[model samples]
Target: AGGQGEGNGLTQLPCPLGLVVDQLGTIYVTDDGNHRIMRWPKGATQGSVIVGGNGGGGQSNQLNGPVGLSFDRHDCDHCEENTDWVLASEPLSHSFQTVKLTHHLLWTVDTNQ
Candidate 1:
């Protein structure tokens, strides 16, 4: 239901290049034009920006023309259970990064290289 618009509306997507879903049925989309990553829960009407929402840039907290997205699970010492991570590809910046989903929170990755 998303298209060319903004905010929490169903028409907030300008250019979406990639998307992935977690085991919990959470939809993650790489909104290219907005230079941000958005998340929508199952049966939800609106989506929320989980990362790169500040604007398009090369900074760790920003994304430039994000294109692809994927998800994987990894074990972590800090937590007793396995955690989910989302892999994002910013083609315009030639950068690839990972974002960890910890306790339903978004943990930005360190893309310092």
Candidate 2:
């Protein structure tokens, strides 16, 4: 139920939650029901798993019912300076996590966003 024609590829993602588009027209989808995030490139047959182990809420880098995801760096201070950061929200844990794409830094925010 997004738009009229494009983006909807007839492949229904159960409990489809998070949504984001990269530069390559790849669609990032957080399939909540499956407890994992998936990505589907434009004109792809199926999605590829990106996160999770189909488990409940925990603090072990596992996803559980993740609702929202944002990769936009327009407002991030150091993002424009070539910092590859991604913000993902986990409502179940009442926290947000910042992931660095280039470097291996995982920072979790306890405050709600």
Candidate 3:
């Protein structure tokens, strides 16, 4: 088995804060340094901008010093498929937020908000 710079087919991603693999083999990228999570779906060439917050002196729906991320599609814990969401930790925000994945991927429902 080969991966990451294996053949130019895939390369090492930067600041991968989180990781997940679906049955379809799609790659979810969380560029923590860049303050965004991009999708590198299977057989894709470029990363698709999925989620990101103000990367500067700001705090928005994207993230605020976002450190962790995860994706779940099932209805669970105050959420459903309609509210399938991503979970991330923000030190600046001093809390965590459950983000809507089915929506704009930016819709977040924060317990501390």
Candidate 4:
């Protein structure tokens, strides 16, 4: 959906590799080039960063080229970064939960329960 040069603007996507549409028609995209996840509300002209966007690194608050995304039953987005960690975020709450992986296995542990 973006042809412009790599940018954080709603219409500019540097290297979007994965996307998912929620039941509310809100689109979530994995902005790999920008190292962030973007949330674009249906019919909106711009999207906001729901996760990452703090530059690429190994920091807890940063993402380096996220490539895949999915949503769990609780509406939390799970993203697989270009590292050994998986990042989860609730767009509405703007909170983050990170999990490290071993042997490239993907699993969810609901700490809230």
Best by lDDT: 4
Model 2 per-residue lDDT tens digits across residues 25-81: 767776565555666777777666655534634433455565655453331211111
TM-score against native, each model: 0.58, 0.52, 0.48, 0.79
Window of ten residues with lowest summed lDDT in model 1: 74-83
lDDT of 3 by residue, 14-38 (tens): 4555555544676665555555555
TM-score top scorer:
4
What is the TM-score (0 to 1) of candidate 1? 0.58
Model 1 ranges with Cα > 4 A deviation: 4-11, 73-113
| lDDT of candidates 1 onward, in order | 0.58, 0.49, 0.44, 0.80
Write candidate 4's Cα lDDT for 23-75 as tens digits: 78998999998898888888887788777888998777788899888877788
Supply the global lDDT for candidate 2: 0.49
The alpha-carbon deviation from the true structure for residue 88 of candidate 3, after best TM-score superposition, in angstroms, is 8.7
Regions of model 3 farther than 4 Å from truth: 1-13, 53-58, 73-113
lDDT of 1 by residue, 40-74 (tens): 88888887776676666655566667666654342
Q: What is the lDDT of residue 68 in candidate 1?
A: 63
Poorest lDDT segment (10 consecutive residues) of candidate 3 = 74-83
